[model samples]
Target: MDFEQGSINISDEVLKEIAFRSFLEVLELSADDKDAKKLKKNIEIERTPDDNVIVNVKTVAPYGKSLVEFGKKIMQNISENIQRMTELQVSAVNVSIIDVVEKIEPAEEEE
Candidate 1:
């Protein structure tokens, strides 16, 4: 975007962060969760020639979840959040389900 004095720019790292957070939100996961921390490393953002962005995300879906519906949710959430927050166009959001795992419950703490 342009202004009288200068132009505003959003960095790639910022875009990636937005995408990662949106992914976690869709899964109802907290940022401090170990899974979320690992998932953060799997997000990538690429800028197009026209200043738009393409987001690629790799994740493991929880078993028994419908993969198609889950992927659609991730795409929609990431795209909307990025566009709403940065005012930048998202050309595409590509999601790759790398694996599927059963939900693991944390062990009860022993006092």
Candidate 2:
């Protein structure tokens, strides 16, 4: 169950889970209708010709927030967290906003 050379292989599922968790921590994402494992198809991880890792993420962002900031934060956080946790150099973190989660508030009664 162990390799003599002490080398380890990280699977796509693991990376997806890590990326999902990192995205969730950004506070700008909607937890509803989001699944790291189930949405594995939306996440793609591959090694570039230079051997650097690239991650593609597709998720829903919370409405009313700055989409630009959201993308930047998601990419930054994902890349940093993934590299830190997995020890894999992430060349890029691509985020595709699939939907927006908006909370509609009820209007107050007029006095």
| Candidate lDDT (C-alpha), each | 0.83, 0.69
Q: What TM-score does each of the candidates earn?
A: 0.87, 0.69
Where does model 1 exceed 4 Å of error? 104-111
Which residue pairs collide in model 1, if any? none
Lowest lDDT 10-residue stretch of candidate 1: 102-111
Every model's Cα RMSD, please?
A: 5.4, 8.2
For candidate 1, write residues 1-111 as lDDT tens digits.
898999999999999999989988887878887645766767889999999999998776778989999999999999999999999999999998867778622111100
Best by lDDT: 1
Clashes of 1: 0
**Candidate 2 all-Cα RMSD:** 8.2
Q: Write the per-residue lDDT of candidate 2 for residues 1-111, one digit (tens) a residue.
A: 137878787876788778877766774334454332355465678787765788887766668888889889989988998889878889999988767677411111001
